[model samples]
Target chain A: MSEIVLSMKGVEKVFGAFRALGPLDLDLRAGERLGIIGPNGSGKTTLINCITGVYRPDRGSIHFQGRDISHIEAHRRARLGISRSFQIPRPFNGMTVLENLLVPLDYCHIDGSKEERARSVLTSVGLAGRISHPSESLSQLELRKLELARALVGDPKVLIADEAMAGLSEGEIDEVLAILLALNRSGVAVIMIEHIMHAVMRFSERIVCFETGRLIASGTSAEIAENPLVRRVYFGE
Target chain B: MFSIDILLNAIVTGILLGSVYASLALGLAITFGILHIPNIAHPTLVVAGAFFVYTLAQWGLDPIVAAVIGLVPFYVLGLALYLFYSRVFERRGGANVLQSLTLFFGLSLVVEILLVLSFGSELKSVNVSYIGSSLKFGALTVPYRLLIPALLGPVMIAAVWLYLSRTNSGTAIRAVAHEERALSIAGLDPAAVKRHAFGIATATAVVAGAALIMIGPVEPFGGRFQIGRVFAIVVLAGMGSIPGNLVIAIVIGVAEALVASYLNPSWSPGVAFAILLLGLAFRPQGLFGAAR
Candidate 1:
């Protein structure tokens, strides 16, 4: 097995009397492409939130690079190379596309001039030509690219993409998928939280499925596809 | 009918007055406009700054130089204020706009009361060589008192604008106001950005205080008269647009000066609100702001 980049052991979360997620154990290896899938309210997002420090897990611990990181603040984790994109793209509406990328770079502590890094990041995300346009004026596909660029500027060790391909067309989805594959090829670990079956299966080397806040299946894409529990939870088969 | 002399004087006076207004609104532009903190006490901070200048002037220091010397302590005070405000309100649930406004309002009153107790209600003025001097150019007359302090306003605004646009930490400050989570995910401590922004806002108070003392005199409760006018300028300029504040402040200043000279001094105060209302109706995002 490759070196574990992230480990979540028996993680649990509760909102008042309602249990959002719990007793979940998972591991992500360096440069791995892992996909998380579940129906609405199945605690998929909740799990991501916990790992990203948006919420503190009620039980269990998360270790990143063998260090206890479950309790660190979100920004500190991001500084430690764990970055996430929001489900809804939240670009600074007042800033230009290039400025959006500049913001994350400013915080990432990357060793380079801000303008140089921002321009390079935008170019990498295929946004080189639209640097001057206001962020709000970006098309839906372009917004996704900006969101990805924002996360990418940090040079994150673990990139948690939450619904990155949502509301994009089929062709756009492929473009995003190719980008993710390229990123993974460069050795950055990625956790793709997606609802689209084909896209998730195509991008992930490993897959995990959740049902009612519990991990129902975890295996390779082919294995997950063949699992009866996953089929029932996903398609009511 | 507007005569050439009247028009020239009004325009010159308006420009000078606008610079003063810019100084007055600069701190609020950062605290309320950029940081989204609705610091109603901003004018009071300016008043406090003016008093500092006055105290230094009494000790034979130039008002402008005194304000400069006071910047460090005021910046530190701003940090403390932000920490307190954040702990009491923002940390609880992120301060709602109305709640913040109320807190700042109370703070303003506390500052005003403290000033009254310390310096009494008498109006205080600072003396310098140029306070009574003026420049003559044909039909236009520009008072040195107005022109010198006025220059400080734009200088401060330009410096801040450059800082916000050209520097890395400045970009983070601008972004923190918009998408706080985005800042967090970018590896920045959002609260720290806000605190820095608040410090920047407070730092402006020192420069503006010097300008206030230089322009004329300031009383313990002088900040009360400026509350509506400064808010009007920040809103009219578009929040967080530092350069935009200069243009908006000048426009309002000219309008107020023209009204005071030609119409009535009483009408000068109303012009700011009128401009604010009109600006909001026409361009709610402000003249230079992106429509959110």
Candidate 2:
């Protein structure tokens, strides 16, 4: 059996009397491809935020690689191999593509020639041709790829891709999906929080659905597609 | 009448003076330009730096050497100041921009008062050997006092520019201002980067102070005269362009020198603002700033 790389036990977050997430239990096995889907404001991002240490969970414990990391800072979490790509794509403007990747490579203290690692990651994400190009000059697809390359440059154990393909067309979506899949094949766990139905369904091995800050459904892709609660949350039938 | 020698002298003096202006604005270029902190206290800090050099010079050290020695202390002072600013304004429920400006403005006043208390409001200048000399070309002569200190501006500016553009940590500093959250996501502490940047900015003040003392005497409130000009350079240069900072400083300096020579000396102070307004009217994002 695969080891449980990340486990959340009865986690909860509250913001100004609003229950943002949890009283929930979730787990991602090592090398697992998990999909998280819900309507907007249904706690998917909140859950990811808690996991990434953007917001400390008001109550609950988060364990990564058997170490409790509930109170660690966001950067510490990234250093410990938990990383994510933002949904809206926040590339460091006024910098070149290579420089953007160097931020992560520099901070993570990745064991390498940082320049070589940055180039390797850029090449992996198919951004090698544009390494010297300014970040603001990149197209939407290139920007998304740059975002993923930054996330991957840290060589994370678990990658939470938050809507990483929101604005891409079908072909562009395929390009990104291939990159994420290739990343997973190299022994990294992936949590795909996405709104695109076909992409999430296709990419995830096990899928989970959320509604009003509660985990409504969890199972294999085939089982989740037919789950009644998830169906109700999505189609409101 | 406008004599050629006077005109040429004004232009040459303007260039030298502008370089000195660049040294003064270098710190603000980081604090206000790149970090966007609106650190109005920077000029006062430069005044403090001059005092540090002055105190050292009282013991018979060269002002330039004294400033070099003062760099680390000034950097630490910057770190402490940034920490105080962060704690009082940033960490205390995230103060609004106006509130931060007020904090910095109030800080400048406090620093000025403190200097007055410590130094007794007397004008202070360093007794360097080169102060009594000038380098005479065929038709023009430049004072060594101004020339040496003026040279400090470009040298330090180039050093800072290289550090920011070349090093790994420097890249983090550049990235933190815009992609702070992304920087954190990339496993860097954004606060730490800014604090270091603030330290670098503050360290420049000592060097600027060294230059200021060489150019002329400085009182506790001497910074009051320079507040307008430094801010103008930072804005006109574009928020974070190091080379642009030097260029704009020279433009304002030459304009001021010409105004002071041809018109009233009082008209020189407004020269920076006039150019700033004119520069902004055409290039609102600044001359070198990328349009956002």
Candidate 3:
């Protein structure tokens, strides 16, 4: 019902002899919360990589904000407002928390002072107190927060968070979920690829399940929970 | 027994020598330390820069003035080299260590051969008014050549350090080595950052070349002898630590001077490696670098 911010048509990604993902189609609407789930190596990462321009899909095309971006470079895609957080936090270890945010802000050429913007992002992520702390010194929770802050600093239109809550405690999971939810509420379309079932279910407005590079089911959370194909592939019934 | 005056003079000379060493190693600090490019051909490039300066000196230009003028073309050459390297190696999932080493080694040989063919195998030196002068301070004598080149190192280092610490492009360069994807996802092209960095690295070679020829005559293959010492300086300085490069270079220079004066002059060449081996064994993160 909403405007399509990102659309993928017949996308396929092959790794030598293996088909890593696609020969399928997907779309993300503007200001929508879409959740994707699959078991280990189920092409979830491949899909995200395709959309973020990390991997050039072997076939088909991707359109973002009505412009074809399948052949665009990853950084240019980011400048066009496509940003993501890695499954494992990959903060620039040599930099401070403030410096980490500054990289994206500076690269994106965002308006206003970089320090003020970095400080504001840090503050939003509840990391205002540790602005000058080196990224290597952060705890697990803070590292996760810093990763999110780095992604958010770009002012991305579409934020693909890949397993961002992995390895966190229930409380930490809740915290990150809240951040993503707040970000979505601010009109940014979010694609959450998470293994935390309860968190994804609670955050997603709609859910899509992937199995071996194909979308097996797409529906509301309740319909997906009741879908037999999703149960079989996700729960291995 | 070593006289107090002799010891003082050796230390002072060592410091001066170390400063020049820092200039030579600055490019490596960027290419190897920051960009993680194992450009073993860096010293060869410095020799090329020296030769370029030498040719220009014939036209009545000061070596330093020629070096400053030469930064532009050398930077463009660096960009082209990085592009060539990335296209051949980095673009296809990155080159392994041995492959990159081999490529750079071959490139160095090519550069040396070119230098030989063009300039002949004979030694070349830059003739400047200050070349034959020295500033005497009591028992200590600082040659104008050594003092001039030595001063260039700290000035360059300070300027580069400020650029790295206080600028956005500089921060992106530092971050590129750590997580290139982080840079990309932040809307900056990682390859472009590396290309720029490589250009900066190569540009430093011009000034360093000027400094080298100021110290003494340079032959086509003069860079070969410096390979080990320069690498030792970069690694011992904690990879990308710009300030650390100067300090470690000075330390190695002083140690080498001490060996030449109190120990054996023949043993002076081994000082860098000895310190490098010790640093790797004891503090692999380097003197100023944090644990990886």
Candidate 4:
């Protein structure tokens, strides 16, 4: 019943003869933390790729804020407030942490004074003192923080975090979850593509499951846990 | 034995000689260093830039001013060139690095051939009041020709440094070289960033061209001779470090001058490669590059 912010209608994607994802329909409402879970090749990334304009879906259209954004380029989509983090951590290896933050501040033109805004954002992501350190030297956890900081710098209306916590330790996962929670609380809608069940359940109010590029189930965390299809897809009884 | 006079003269001349080398390599430092384009044809573009200066010089404009004026058109040309390259190669999931190399190589040839057809393969030089003068301070005698071109290096380096560090567009150029995807997340089109960067790189070619013609004569095929030398400067400076290139260019210039004066002039061409190999052996990322 909440105002829908993004609508994906009958979206389909294929790579050559292989159907990678979709012919699926989904909607994301304002201020919702929706967790998308799927097995390794169940097209979770592919779906995000389409929505973020990394790939042009073969069939159907994506409506963002009531605009048909199917043919828009990825960067344009980002400019329009849709941003995605890659599954693998990708900080600019050749820049310092501070320089990395300045890149987004400058590129997005979010604020007039780049230096002041970059410093503020670095502090917001708990990277205030490490600004001058080289990005390649960042620890795994630090890298994840930098990745999140990168997504947040654009002041995106919708943030698609594709496995942002993957490869982090349990404690680091909690740290990132806290950051996501904080971001959601700031009124940004988030689509978390995660394989970690407990974390997803803890973070998501609603959940969606995918199997072979098809949406298998969508419901509250408790209802999804009770669904028979969700059980068979996971436990394969 | 090296006399005090010879030593002083060699050092002074080395500084002058380094300035010319810096001018020649400036465009490459931006193109290959900043953009990671591996634009082997950069020196050729500088040569082309020199020819443009020559044309305007014949029209009686100051060569330096001519080069500055040429920047806008060259920037636009660079943008078009990058767009074409992206459309043909990068858009197709990036045809292996070597494939891109071959494309640039072919492009270099086409440009060289076109230059030959248009300019008739004749070596051309610029004429100015300072072109034939020299400055003397005690035992040191510096040719005005050397002094003029030498001065261009530092001034241009400072200007480029300011642009790269103090401007918003400058940061975008540096970012594109490091992590292109980061640009997308920042709400900028990666293609546009690259195109703008390519334009900046090409703009340098005109300045370098002015310096080249001021120092000596240039022909269409002259770029081939500078290919290795320019690349060495860019790599030794570290990719995208604009101010760093000035220092490395000077060092290589002094080394080449020393080699030509004491060892053998014929061996000057090898100085860039030797220094490049040694620089890679010690700090592969370059003198100023971030350790990755």
Candidate 5:
């Protein structure tokens, strides 16, 4: 079995009267491409938030590389090699695209020249030409790419791409998928939280489905596709 | 009708006065403008800084030299204050805006009282040989004290602008205002960045204080009159725009000088507000601010 990069055992999150996620256990292995799919408000975002340390789990523990990191702050977790892109891209305005990449590189204290690292990351995301352009001027496709680039700039071990391709066109979606696939091939693990069915199915080596914050099914794409519970909750069939 | 010679002198004097205003407003630009902290205590802190310079000046140190020496302690003070503020209000995610304002307001009052107790609230002035002199160029005569402080504004602004644009920590400070989460995700502690930025802002107070005392005498409550005027400069400069801050300060200075010459000298205090209101009514993003 591959080494587990991230493990959450019996994690839970509650908001006021509502239990947003868990009493759940999930594991992501090194270099794994895992997809989490659920309907809107099915706790996909809550789970991501829990993992990224935005919202600490109300119960249970999260272990990264076999150490309990349940109480670690979000930035500490990010420095320890977990990074995520936002559902709605939050680019720092009043900055050039190159400067956006430089922020993460600078904050993370990654050794090497920041400008060089930013240039390389921008190149990897096919945004090398737009380096000097203002981020506010970027198109939708460029914004999505910039989001992914920001997440990837830290050289994260596990990247939680939250709805990265949500509003993109078909061609744009494929472009992003190609980037993710390329990233996975380079030994980085990815946890994609997406609503788009085929893309997730095509990309994920393992798939998990959530309904009302509870995991109803987990399997390969074919197995999840055939799972009657997943169909009933997802398609209402 | 305005005489040409009087108008020219007023314009020159306004430029000089504007430079001093820019220095006074610089710290606020960082605290309230860039960090979004609404540090209402900033002017009072400037007064405190003047006291620091005054005490140091008694030891035969130049005001500028004393201000440089005073920067370290003020920075540490700012860092501690921000840490306290973040713990009490920011981390809790409750009533941050109103609570922070009240906290700083109370802090300002406390600082004022402390200054009064320590210095006896008497008007204090820094004495230097050059202060009594003036430079005469043809029909223009500029007082050395005003010219020296005026020069400090551009120098300080240039240094601050370069730091903000050219360095890594400076970039983080710029980004911290826009999105805390973004900074966190980038592997930086948002609170730490804010604390550092606050320290830099507070460090600026000493320099501003030096300039303030150089321009004239300062008492514990002297900052009270400047509260509205300094804020007007920051807002008119468009929040955190450093270079813009200097330009707007000069413009307001010129207007105030013109008003004092042609209109009523008493009305000069109101000139900044008048221009501020008019500026906001037209280009609300400020002269240099990008459209949000």
Candidate 6:
């Protein structure tokens, strides 16, 4: 295997009477594109939460770049190059586009002029022309770009797109996919937690399917699509 | 007969008084307006600050100097207060309006009772040379006490506004209340930002306390009278609008002064609520705030 950037082993989470996730193992190589697919409440969110330090796993260890980081706080993880976009685009409203990017650059401890870095990220996301526009003024596509730009501004080693394409039209989805591809090409690992079948299949080199908190299937997009368990869980008996 | 001279003097008085009100409400603009904390205890904190200044002023210290001295301690108090509050509420997910109201109301009472135990319920005023004198110009008589303290409101407002608008930590404070997770993604702890903002808010209480005592004597219960009006000012200005706080404060101040001069002084306290209700009916987002 390619040098693993993130390694999770036997990571399990429980909520009172329910085991939300794990007793599972997963790995992502540096600069790889990974897709995570699961029906609602299959523990994808819980997994992401544990990885981002939003919640402790209650079991197991997660190592990032050779260092165990299961107990680190969420923001510290972001500083450590683990960043995520919310399923619902959560742009810092009332702030201008440049100001939105500045929030991350401000705290990322990135060495450079914040204004220049913000401007450059906005440009990379094709938002250079709308730099000063208020976040509320952006169209759906633009807001999505802003969220990605926010994640990008941290210069994260791993970027999690949590339903980033939910409400976008097909054309808009292509635009976002292109951005993610470009980001991945720049050596950032991407985890596309997507429900859109075609897009995920197209973007992911490796796809994993989750059913009731366990990894039911793991393979290339072609293998996942053919997996009997994945089809039964996703489609029907 | 409504005398032009009396009218002018009342108008000037209202403007001066409005500055004082701005000083009082500036902290609220950050605490309630920005953070949405509904800190009903702020006025009482102002009273505590006044008493602090009083203790120092007894040794012939300037009220302003005393206010400056108390800033760090008051800031610490604010940080501790926010830490406790977030522990009780935010960490449990979020604080509902009723829960926050009750918490702050209880805190206000505690502070008031503490003030009583320490300083007694008696009225206290600081003795400064400028306090006893008034400036006369063109039929308007302005007290130096009001003018000097009035300047604090604009100065404080400008300083805070600049910090919030131009600085990095300031941006984090503004962003924390809106989308807290965004701050997390930005690598900032949301609770820390809120605590810092709350500390800044409480720090202003000392300056405003100095202003309050300079205007007139203050008792432990002095803040109770202001609670309603300061809330009205923050709401009417539109939440999170710094400049709007000053403008609305002045408008309410002028109206109250006009009312006291032309109508009844007792009715003056009602002026803020009256404007607040009417302003809300018209611009629910606030006079200067962005629509939610």
Top candidate by DockQ: 2
User: Which of 2 and 4 is the better model by lDDT?
Assistant: 2
**Interface RMSD in angstroms for candidate 2:** 0.6
Candidate 4 C-alpha error for residue B5, in Å: 2.2
| C-alpha positional error of residue B244 in candidate 2 after TM-score superposition, expressed in Å | 0.8
Candidate 4 chain A: worst 10 consecutive residues by lDDT?
A104-113
Instruction: Using lDDT as the measure, name the better of candidate 5 and candidate 6.
Output: 6
lDDT of 3 by residue, A180-202 (tens): 98899899999999998988999
lDDT of 4 by residue, B180-230 (tens): 776776677778888888888788888888888898899999889888888
Which TM-score value belongs to model 5? 0.98
Q: So what's the TM-score on candidate 6?
A: 0.97
DockQ of each: 0.82, 0.89, 0.84, 0.65, 0.81, 0.78
lDDT tens digits by residue: candidate 4, A47-141 = 99898888889999999999999989888888788877777778876668877777766656554776767777678778888888988889877
Give the alpha carbon lDDT tens digit for every residue of B154-224 in model 6: 99899999999898889888898699877887788888889999999999999999999998899998999
Off by over 4 Å in 6: none
Query: Model 1 segments beyond 4 Å from truth?
Result: A107-114
How does model 4 score on DockQ? 0.65
Writing each residue's lDDT as its tens digit, candidate 1 over A22-73 gives: 7899999999999999999999999999998989899999999999999999
| Weakest ten-residue segment in model 3 chain B by summed lDDT | B283-292
TM-score of chain B of each: 0.98, 0.98, 0.99, 0.96, 0.98, 0.98
C-alpha RMSD for every candidate: 1.5, 1.0, 1.3, 2.0, 1.1, 1.5
Give the distance in Å from residue B183's predicted Cα in candidate 5 to where it truly belongs. Answer: 0.9
Give lDDT tens digits, candidate 5, residues B154-273: 998898889998888888888887888978988889888999999999988898999999989999998888889989989878899999999999999999999999999999999999
Worst 10 residues of 3 chain A by lDDT: A103-112
| Residue-wise C-alpha lDDT for candidate 6, range A50-110, written one tens digit per residue | 9898898899999999999989888888999999988888888878999888888876666
